[model samples]
Target: GGWPDAVTGSKKNALRRAIQYVETIIQTDISSVDNIRKDPVKVRDLMLSLARNTATVATVKTIRDDMVRGDADNALSAPTIYGYLNALERMFVVEDLPAWSPSLRSKTTIRTSPKRHFVDPSIATAVMRLTPGRLLKDFLFFGFLFESLCIRDLRIYADGNDGQVFHYRDANGLEADAVVVLNDGRWGAVEVKLGTKEIEEAAIHLRKLKERINTEKMMEPSFLLILTAGTYAYRREDGVLVVPLACLKD
Candidate 1:
């Protein structure tokens, strides 16, 4: 069969360029590739690295070398890394969660920084070149990225459900990573953690939110969700929901 005329023109050129980019990184020798698939710790490190360097994304080759050196010195070309991340995202391997705010009072106000996340932890590990052994020391960084990932998944799940994803931060420095509003105007708050322990801190933020916005006028029956890395999901004694990150997906 002959190649279609449309496929022989601009489309073909674009495909060739994309394939070249993929080949450039995939063809490199990086032993960490296998480790990334086998170790969850490695995965967590990679995602945290990316989160720490939110100013830019790196290419596979750069990320590979950086993993070895423990720095971003050999970071990938910005555009190349972005393309690779985008491909991973399309495959549900990674996700770049964007920050959002509601137009409750004025439509002109919007959040400035958007957070990024990966869908599958393994993909993040591969990109960052981390191994399983490194996770223990890097738990805090992983926690933040994990929360970002959970928020991304929850936002996707809440789509078309009359709920909007928002991050709350006041002038005094109180903040909540995520907020979901139901169709009836009821809302839920979420805080992401790496482990199942220490959810009271999350609850404190929820309480602060309630205090900032008068409950009788603007708030509904609120819930504080603490997304953990554990396997189980349950409500805490304080009425907060401690959910596993896996249960948040659509």
Candidate 2:
């Protein structure tokens, strides 16, 4: 009913038309900015990769490599690529989930790279030309898209509460899909699971994160959440809330 539904014959045609409209806006902004080069192809390819993968923590080098693979003849220099990415971000075409680094009880090092996502999940699908049937056959990729969608919504809800959304990952490999933080220091951790089978593993990660943080320095989390694409919603005995994505509101 969103991007996937727009990926076919007529729907795709309409989507492309919309993209053309957006491109015009972007180009106009680039001209006004003056310092940034306007490379439509590179920016478009980056959008495709963002859609195809979930919220992959990406560096400038990784993105440049992707651009090279997408079109070697016109591969962009790293600095130029960085400029393009920054421009897109300024235009609200993409956003980053900065890594959360709470004072830890243990000395585990945390990854600092930001997880990259589109402002809306539809942008990725439109850039990638992914249809619903194609997504259904590729459950793994679909799961990533679902996670991106969850983060998009989480950002909205968190903003309403005067908070920001982040992601977490440590050297030991523990991770949380999203972390919501308020200015007063209260925070919540979340994991996005597209299926019931993943709920246990996600809950375990959230629990481990809570255990690792030094509560003396930072307030204990306001709550832990497991957002799902399934039909049911409930609270686990351990106090983690498992709510269907559709049920969430700001």
Candidate 3:
């Protein structure tokens, strides 16, 4: 069912509508989920944690450390956070991007921490109360949220192909934003770039990651994609695909 109508009616102001919609969601939905005491405050803070660290590798220690650095008094213990995380997982509120591990040409220590993300990126924006104007003022954070959104879409698309989306980063900081590996073991790499200017660097990184993979032990990547916010989608001469985000729906 399309969600039952919210009380945001007749609100011509988009920001007001958005805020009321999220509030309505929390009061109406979070209260109904099973397996947890109904503490909206804890759930709210849990969401705040995901918002602050979205698209980054956030382990329990990572979240606890980040929180402690911000406000020691407000920091949730690791056990508390784990309990909330489990509840959110059951409710599909958070779906982390697991790390991709492949045999490498070098002995680079792969960072196995899962990248933190919400089922929908807008949850971060909503809980953070960030409008598009506010997001525009902090473009770097905007990019992080953009990556979260891209990852969300990639997960949806990968679902049809029996593929799982993973992220990759090694000790040396080499990384890919999304790695779609199918059940049969074929895989593809993707980098989410919000601008055309970054496509060149993203493409270079994708190629570097492919090189790091020990292809002899695994199938060569079926594709290398640079997903961006550009207006057009095309193939680069170097065999990398530069696809606009809009093309995904098409």
Whole-model lDDT, model 1: 0.56
Give one digit per residue, the lDDT tens place, for model 1 in 35-134: 2222233333444455454312344554555444654554445454545455445545455544534333223334445455544343344454445466
Best candidate, TM-score: 2
| Candidates, ranked, lDDT | 3, 2, 1
lDDT of 3 by residue, 85-158 (tens): 87677777789999999999899999898999888776778788887778899988988988888898889899
Model 2: residues >4 Å from true position, as ranges? 1-37, 70-73
Q: Which candidate, 1 or 2, would have the higher lDDT against the true structure? A: 2
- Give the winner by lDDT: 3
Model 1 per-residue lDDT at 95: 54
Tell me the number of clashing residue pairs for each predicted model.
3, 0, 0
Lowest summed lDDT window (length 10), candidate 2: 25-34
Off by over 4 Å in 1: 1-51, 54-111, 118-121, 160-162, 215-217, 246-250
Q: Candidate 1's error at 210, in angstroms?
A: 1.8
Q: TM-score of every model? A: 0.55, 0.88, 0.87
